[model samples]
Target: MEWTQILTLAAKEFRDRMRNRWVLAVALVFTVFSLVIAYFGGAQQGAVGFRSIEFTIASLVSLVIYLIPLIALLLGFDAIVGERERGSLDLLLSLPITRLELLLGKYLGLAAALTLSTLAGFGLVALLLWQRIDTAGLYHYAGFMLSSVLLGLAFLSLAVLVSVVARDRTRASGLAIALWFFFVLVFDLLLLGVLVGTGGRFGGEAFAWLLLLSPADVFRLLNVFSLDDVRTLYGLASIVPTSLGSPGVMGGVMLAWIALPLVVARWRFK
Candidate 1:
């Protein structure tokens, strides 16, 4: 738990990603996609240009949900396993660093890279739209960016856990993609299908609790509930309970998603 050693390892991880151009590639992806969505997302409605921050954020939420988790998984799914395959894991373990410090260092470094890219990508768009948005709109956009970072960190934690448990990088990657698919695509559909088939008998108040299981959903609720226009646009006004919609609640849930996986990964790595 020595801060100096942890920070040194974290700096090394960050530098490795930089040397590999991982940061540049991800930052470019974020910037391009965000700019496109901000300007052209409303084209179907015969609208084009920098629309309201609400609409931009709403569109960005969908993009972040799909993109961030995949990037995080790709970035971290092989963190441990790849090292092991390269014969570096044992060498690193032989150093003066404790396992907890090593794990935390790696996580911090990856999280920093993700956060920097996310902010750079989305922050550029926010700058472009700065003059177009009001104070409230700016606040909403900022909140969206923060939550997007949280979502990435959550998935990265999962990837770390996958890396810890998998026998090799191939299996780690497969598990990471499966994790993304389950949380992003399949989980909600299955929940809805169950609710429909059972006619609300199976999932009553518990339905909302179920949404917390998926970090993406928690991120969605955090953003969607913040803006009135976006809330109604998503048709979540009636379905989402007031208590569960609180920023405090959703933020806590997102933090839990980030922490729980890292805890498990720490245990497994040990």
Candidate 2:
């Protein structure tokens, strides 16, 4: 792919996204939400003299993991198919640009938009926590936020892939939204079912592999695993060893999911 063409297309799409009020509006709402959640969680939890910043950041991370992924889906669910529905994709594709270039451009542009918004939320949360009180594990909290932000990118890539494959905006939006629900919401319910049916007992590596199949679980594992002492001492769902193959392994799994769907989408688009 030509860097010139890719960057040109990326710039154009970036401008389009910036002009789109929905993107900015969503980001604004999310930023405020982060501030509110962090403040209250810190004030309420830490005032009993517990380190409120830690709980505040942890709660914010869980909220980020779920909502950021959904935002990624909502913003990107119609990237290409929406153009087709509005009767513009044919005209756009008819230009001098190659499909590969279009794919790379749109992905980079849309992903960058999502990244900017996600970082805005993280920045606000970090700022709030930094000013209020001294937290013990600041680096760990930052790690959790950074990891969740990347995981959000993975979700955006998934939505972009879906957008490219669908024939029109409505179908693309429906499928992409469905996928977000399945992976983020329903998949967790399914895991809970398995845990319940088996009496919440984990035997071996198969359980680890099953948990790895879920982007949500991989994310939760990262957020929770870092607090091993917290998990052991608190006993908050620590029984079923989420002791996955380290943070790197989970990161690799999330990245693979992000790449695989786009590769399939490109082939389908071709």
Candidate 3:
């Protein structure tokens, strides 16, 4: 409710990240990985150079699927718990800001840092691809960048939730990594195991809806379903119905993924 207090806290948090060069480091990592993928993504196909935006995005999607979530998780897993471990949580709580304002400030500051890094990193690639891609390609590539930010924010929200729930930084980090592995690595495999073990009869039509459980999958669908060529390349195109593939629908699901975790975190923190 107190904008000044929240903004002050947020500014402090953001400045800490800047002072420590966390934002710069993450941005550089994204820049290097993206540039490499864009240019050498086709090396295995006996070709090496910047390909079409579609192909570049496809390769980048796989990279973002693995990288962004982990980065976001590590960045935020210790937000509150780290404060507690350093004996600063009580000092922060003694401030005039309400707990809600404090939580929102922390989350917003971290989100801003992540968003800036993502945009700067990928925006550089967008600039490099400007001459190569047409208007349509620009549109698709822009969408990919936006969705990548959302995916990171959603996972960061989960990390904040973990920070609130765990008693210490060590447990918070362990839970954070477990969450990353479960959502990024194990969730889909488990879904597939069930679908395959049951001969697809168990998860036929409802499979697409089930993908909503993992923000990573939702991010994948958001990108893959938009492009016709890339859509076919992904098996989800067949499993995810056209109804669930709408940009608006998938975007809403992603927004929910971002919000629900924060809501739960706030409740638990209270």
Residue 110, model 2: Cα distance from true site in angstroms: 0.8
lDDT of 1 by residue, 173-212 (tens): 8999999999999999999999999998898668888999
Go through the candidates in order and give the C-alpha RMSD of each one to the true structure.
0.9, 3.0, 0.9
Model 3 CA lDDT for position 175: 98
Superior by lDDT: candidate 1 or candidate 2 = 1
Global CA lDDT computed for model 2: 0.73
lDDT of each: 0.91, 0.73, 0.92
lDDT by residue (tens digit), candidate 2, 184-213: 789867867877788767433356567677
* Cand. 2 TM to true fold: 0.85
45-73 per-residue lDDT for model 3 (tens digits): 99999978888888999999999999999
Cα deviation at 48, candidate 3, in Å, is 1.0
lDDT of 1 at 156: 96
